[model samples]
Target: MAAEASPAPYADLGGENTGPVYTQSKGDTLAVRGYDVVSYFTGDGVPVEGSQEFTVRYEGYDYRFASKDNADAFVAEPAKYAPAYGGYCAWAIGANDALAPGDPNVYKIVDDKLYLNFSEDVATKWNADIPGFIASADVNYPTHAPDEHFQD
Candidate 1:
């Protein structure tokens, strides 16, 4: 099942949300909607809900983990685990230069990086041309993404 998303709090930037990370709402610091990012790479390769007990702050966002080991793993190399494009829907950023909420339940690991999509349908579109989209997003994200966490 898809996780519930919080109401968007920031005003749209030309009809697109602009930020370095995708939080559910303004003033919310939880990354990946509190899903364990490390879990996406470890063990069964299935994402698991993180515990508040094991949380780490990185790049101005709070990342939760299912266990201390996972947290430590994240701390060791955050860039390795952080979702590409700050957890925004990969296809959206790549195809549209738009910031759409990335569903943790719908994810893909590409070139050893975790990438999230808006939904299964978007994932389908993304899967069609991964390399091309990545190239476009690579050029678009830096231009569209703001340096700050939240920009209104």
Candidate 2:
């Protein structure tokens, strides 16, 4: 019998994808819909930018926070405060560290650590090799440099 060829060891080989990705910023706790940060599983979205409490829906999920302070706290340590994949797009992470938009449903917790990706297509690839790809991505991310990865 003839030998079979191995599949390419990449989430997205072409790396020609455009999508939203999880962003890490100082005050990024505010949800895309302008809702305050809250336990994805527990509370509804509150207005983190102000002291007022409000509710908002994202990706078909409802979230809430008691007050702006609570939302700020949640945003400060999202990995510890938000649900898995609740704040980041998963597929993006799996495929060449592409920036994926946040998906509240798709998530994974490895060694109690949270990571996010872009889309379901990207996520499927990410789930294939959690440790290996993540390690490589982490290593590659820092040294990727602005000019090499980004052209502004």
Candidate 3:
């Protein structure tokens, strides 16, 4: 299907939004770099690039989906699909409480929540101590993150 412009904003899907969902730039509201967040949980667990035609705006960010089904799934339960730590690099948030770009291609699903890392190398480090890092991030993220997207 063809893509379209993002639709009007929807109600803020309540969650402990650590920070603004990561986007390519300050003006960019596309979460997960336009990847289908729900795709991470379905099929082979490989995330698929999303189309603007299946977009949903939630929590001040626009999430795209590979299909209408995925979009509808997100609309039903955004917190379940939205990336943790506001789509920031998992390692950065967990280890340093810093905001770093999370590569959509490098991700993990732990305890049913999706987490993203900066790169393969970062993912390796993060994978070494997932639980520990999550514990640290769970404490650090809400306290340190500003209520805005990174001004890249």
lDDT of each model, Cα atoms only?
A: 0.82, 0.42, 0.84
Q: Residue by residue across 1-152, what tens digits does model 1's lDDT show?
A: 99986444221112222447888886787889999999999999999998877877776677788998988888788889989988888999899988888999999999999999999999999999999999998887787544434334
lDDT of 2 by residue, 25-124 (tens): 4223233333334433333422233222433323323334555455555445544644333344444443465433554444455665555455566678
Worst 10 residues of 3 by lDDT: 9-18
Q: Estimate each model's TM-score.
A: 0.83, 0.43, 0.86
Count of clashing pairs, candidate 2: 23
Q: List the residue pairs that clash in candidate 1.
A: none
Where model 3 places Cα greater than 4 Å from the true spot, the runs are 1-18
Better TM-score candidate (1, 3): 3
Candidate 3: residue 29 Cα off by (Å): 0.7
* Regions more than 4 Å wrong, model 1: 1-19, 145-152
Q: What's the number of clashes in each of the models?
A: 0, 23, 0
Model 2 weakest lDDT span, ten residues long: 9-18
Give the top-scoring candidate (lDDT): 3
